[model samples]
Target: MNSDTRPLPQFAHAPLLLLIIAFLMMQPLSTDLYLASLPTLSSDFKVPLSTVQLTLSLFVIGFGSAQLVIGPLSDRYGRRPVLLWGLALYAVGSVLCGLAPSIELLILARFLQAVGCCSAVMIARAIVRDAYDPVHSVKVIARASTWLSLAPLLAPILGSYLQVAFGWRAAFAVHTLLSVSLLLLTFLRLPETNLHKNPGATNFAGLSHSFRLVLGSREFWAYALPGALSYGSIFAFISGASIVLIQVLHVPTAYFGYCFAIGVSGYLSGTLVCRRLLSRLGATATFRIGSAISLGAGTLFLAAVLAGFAHWSVMVAAMFLTLSAHGINFPIGQSGAVSPFPRQAGTAAGLMGALSMLVAFIVGSIVGATHNGTLYPLGLVVCALGLSIFAATRLLAPAEAAA
Candidate 1:
């Protein structure tokens, strides 16, 4: 669809809004619900803490890898059918995760769940890009991000309560219901948004050419790579936060939710702030500024830990700042990277998301592997990503940032 032809939507179309919002909400739910189960899942699996951690890493890996394949397919086919299939797969995976008798089985099931979940999220971003320009797209994504951000923030608390009440398996049961309902909603209400579809037009060569164009652009990577790293940093926390909160600080199990809620507020704040600023500073400049704060926060977090003054409260505060920084960085990076590629919004969103997941996998693997009951390594890596983003933007120069 031509950008000029599609007028900006003002939330009147509840069906379309629900379509994307439903998909968007699942991510946070997945992260949050699953995260709370981490501690209990280890004992249930009869596996080492590190191995249980692998489940989270693999979920991200499956989630990221699947996006590249599904995004392009949706672009070729249609959004509704792809979303339907993916959600169904996710539901099946959820059932498997809930019923699994072994840690190995649980890990495998989580991977499957993630693989199926990838389609909705990737398509959500592409759908926005398909319908709106960079500015409007930023706002839409930021608005959606609040729902997404809350998932991880609230997930642990929710997961913790569910784990305490029933068992780790019950959490998956809840996920299964949500996934099924979304699937039914899709069959009943979903619509076509792929304005760029043409079976005969975009052959293999056209597909290759579009990807090549994305790769050859310095700005795409300039925005994408750093954004990916920022998430990598966040993954470090995702993988390690439970350890720091529950294991190290010896916080009451029930109180873990409170800490997670506090950090989540930062993300919510960033989302609200970005909406106000996207029109003024634009995605590029706003993203650069956010990157600086992320980097700065990471460094300060590292120093505090090294000085032997860092505690759970201190780390929680640092995390809040960094999460907020991510809130701002993600919407801008997402909108900016895809802004230059309107025709292939699905493909573009898929590729950017894939890069992000890959980065997160790498960082998460490192943090998970070398965990030593300290946040030093994780904090350092997050700071490094922030700096890299800042450096990349400086080198690319604002004039050429969106190249």
Candidate 2:
């Protein structure tokens, strides 16, 4: 088979590929795993609920900020050493989190954990770009995301079970074990992907020039911004849905996890559908279908609420469709953004992750602030986000219907 024209493999025992996917999947797990435990953490530390929420925001800020620095460092050095070191630090942070005696310390540990987890996420994407052509790279990323979606799917239920079975500290213990595994895997098999690792490009001019290359491309915004905004909506849900489901909607606390899992089921289905159709249907086609469904879902949600169809089942079903749309679109848009710069994949990924997380941070912060005991605030943001996504895509490809 010609190198670029080969059929995509749906399964691989390639140890390096498995290891990288594991680490990438784990990043989201770290973010999601703590969600169910946040209340217990607050009670344990004698802190207010909002103070505990700060850890979530703080970890996001650190995770996003660290990528800007880590990407360049990995580019200069190699993916393996960087990943190993980051995983090592992540393990240490996880231990600290498990042992943290106070809320402040727990928040600090979470930030440190983010600083480490961000490395896996950025490097995993970069390494994929290094291993395959842009198209194949995207397929691989889609497969990776398919696995990663499990974190959100299973984390809440698992976290709740663990918290009840053991304690909040068990969540961090889970973190520590996986962190160590990734660290060892990196040491054993992670390959270097910086093909153009010339010493000269390490200077200020080269770095500035990297920004120029990325910024100069309208393609970046066309692909990145829509998906970023849509992805940010997920973050909005993460920040707001706890109260909306458990408090406002009068769902039991334990059952709230099922609500979260319902959304994840949508995402998983979207991921599966996207993966199946990705190579056959182009990114734009995939996005158009997914976004339309998502927009419809969001509108249906608003209509349901207004019509007083706010039964738990109704809410769960609407959210399921909405999040499934996210699953369909997230990987497609991400593939569009990172597939362009094969040589500078680390920098490419770094830029995308950094900006995407920054957007999520802003949206998440707003959700945290505007949170009331109702779903209106969250639903409004999702609707606006859906509309914004439709506008961005239409602007990006004005001939969407024609295409």
Candidate 3:
């Protein structure tokens, strides 16, 4: 590998890679690990299912919004301090969540936890951008994503067991412990990768200009919007899968996690395939392929729903296909979005994350609101989002070719 493509020299690549993967895993672990507990949470707090679901939407909102500030701060101050503080806050938030006595308190704590966890996510991307050039960054991100997907693969299974044995609070307790461990590892191991830190970037004027530049870039929008929609479709399933599977389709709660793991396996397979294909087909071709896969999967899912074959197997199969597409598209979209603004990597990563999470929040809320004891809402939203992804990619083809 070219020196520019390697990780920073002060740290060993293996250890640094592990740390970054750990950082990438936090967000998914935080959310997915407790998915099996949503019904339990609803019962515990004596709230309706929709109210319990708000906790997730709120987390997305807080997590997305926090990245807007954390990214700029990382650019202004340094990655290490921001990461350390974020992890500490995440630990505090997780502890509070574990002890929360009401749905209201739990929602607030989840938001705080999300805000803190967002730092690890956005900053991990920034660090990859900081440490490597665009080409290598994509590969690194793909590998990290493969590792990240494992969280979802295992989290639900582990969470189901926890919920079955120790109750929902155990999940938050685990999150607290993980956060503290990560904080210490970050403090001791992770180095300052923002060698070109712009102290002025924290100022309002500088921040505004950077946001404008990133938001104004046609290329970024072209790359990001489809990926965000794809992500939103997957999150729609995440937000509603438990209800659909456990309540509607009547899958046993214990086995629900195993079925969920099947979808994550698709994502893992896609990322592994993406790693190989990135070298051969390059990002644009690979991205198009992923989008097409998602569109096709969405179409099939809708057709199945329309045909009244909305079984657990059908839902799992559709989710597997859609998530696989996401696995392929996400790293490529992220790499493409940040590639043009190497100097403002933090801002770019943050904005992209914000857009993606905003889409998630919207989709989650929609699913929560429209859920009517069937998979219709999930199918409709996912299919529509997939169509949007396909159209966006087609519309952007000329611009991509010119670039």
Candidate 4:
């Protein structure tokens, strides 16, 4: 169907918005909820922190790579079927993750779980495109992201408690249950949103063309680069924070969630700020401010660590500032990247999401590899990603504003 020429609905129904928020939450929920268990996992499996880190880095690899296919498959078939199957796979993978006896097995399971969970996030953006015009979709995504931040805010806290009470594997048990529940909800309540299905989307030539169409657009990279880097900064924290907070700084494992929650609260706050800024300033202006905050916060963080202020509070505070900026940049980035390709929204969403995860995987690997039992590496990564985000914004904002 030629949806490119048609006017999309101005807004999505309220129920669908809830589903989208819930779907989007899967990504954070998958990682953050078990983050507090990283140390415990390392101890239990008789492995080093770097080996345990593989679970996360590999999950990003699977999640990012799968979206390349899932998004196109949704565009070829429809969002509903793909989502249903994805949730089911997630449930199975979660179960496997909980049952695995070895770190290697757990890493493999995480990759599987990630592959399934990718559908929720990638399709959520596509559905937004199906329902709204580009400009309006940005507003909708930003507002939804405000609610979505709650996952990261609460997941770690909940995970910490769950770890103390039952064990690290409890997180996967919860994931299994949640995935099943979401699966039922999808099957019963979620309607098909991809009305403009392109039969050729899954074909090799068609997929390549769709990719080129999105990639060739200057607008997509402008947002995608900043978005990926901001997320990379956050991932740097996610992959490294537990060790820093619990091992180096001597924070209690049980208390780690509260500290993590404080940083994530920045994301919630940033999303609120994002909605306000978008109303008054527009996308390009919002990007500029957000990127500046990210760069400035990252610099302060690295400087603090370098000056021998290697405190958990410093790390958490720095994360809070940078992630708050992420809250601002991410929605704008996602909407902007997909905006130019109405008919190729799934392809655009997938490609953008893939880039974010790819950057995250690289960042996570670096953090893992460079862990010298000190704060310097994490600080360097966050600062470098922030600088990159600022650079990308500077290059794109003027052009976007002019356009």
Q: Evaluated with TM-score, which candidate comes out highest? A: 3
TM-score of each: 0.93, 0.92, 0.97, 0.96
Task: In model 4, state the lDDT of residue 127.
Answer: 88
lDDT of 4 by residue, 3-117 (tens): 3213354333336778889999999999999999999999999999999999999999999999999999999999999999999999999999999999989999999999999
**Clash-forming residue pairs, model 2:** 266-324
State residue 243's C-alpha deviation in candidate 3, in Å: 0.6
lDDT of each: 0.77, 0.75, 0.88, 0.91
For each candidate, how many residue pairs have backbone atoms clashing (under 3 Å)? Answer: 2, 1, 0, 0
Ranking by TM-score: 3, 4, 1, 2
* Model 2 stretches astray by more than 4 angstroms: 1-14, 398-403
| Deviating ranges (above 4 Å) for candidate 3 | 1-5, 8-14, 397-403
Q: Write the per-residue lDDT of candidate 1 for residues 236-308, one digit (tens) a residue.
A: 7777777778887777667777787787778888888877777678777788788888878788887787788
Residue range with the least summed lDDT across 10 consecutive positions in model 1: 3-12
TM-score of 1: 0.93
Q: How would you encode candidate 3's per-residue C-alpha lDDT over 62-173 as one tens digit per residue?
A: 9999989999999989899999999999999999999998999999999999989999999998988887666688898888899889999999999988989999999999
* Candidate 4 wrongly placed segments (more than 4 Å): 1-14, 398-403
lDDT string, candidate 2, 307-386, tens digits: 76656776677768877888888887777777777655667677788887898888788777777656666777777777
User: Evaluated with lDDT, which candidate comes out highest?
Assistant: 4
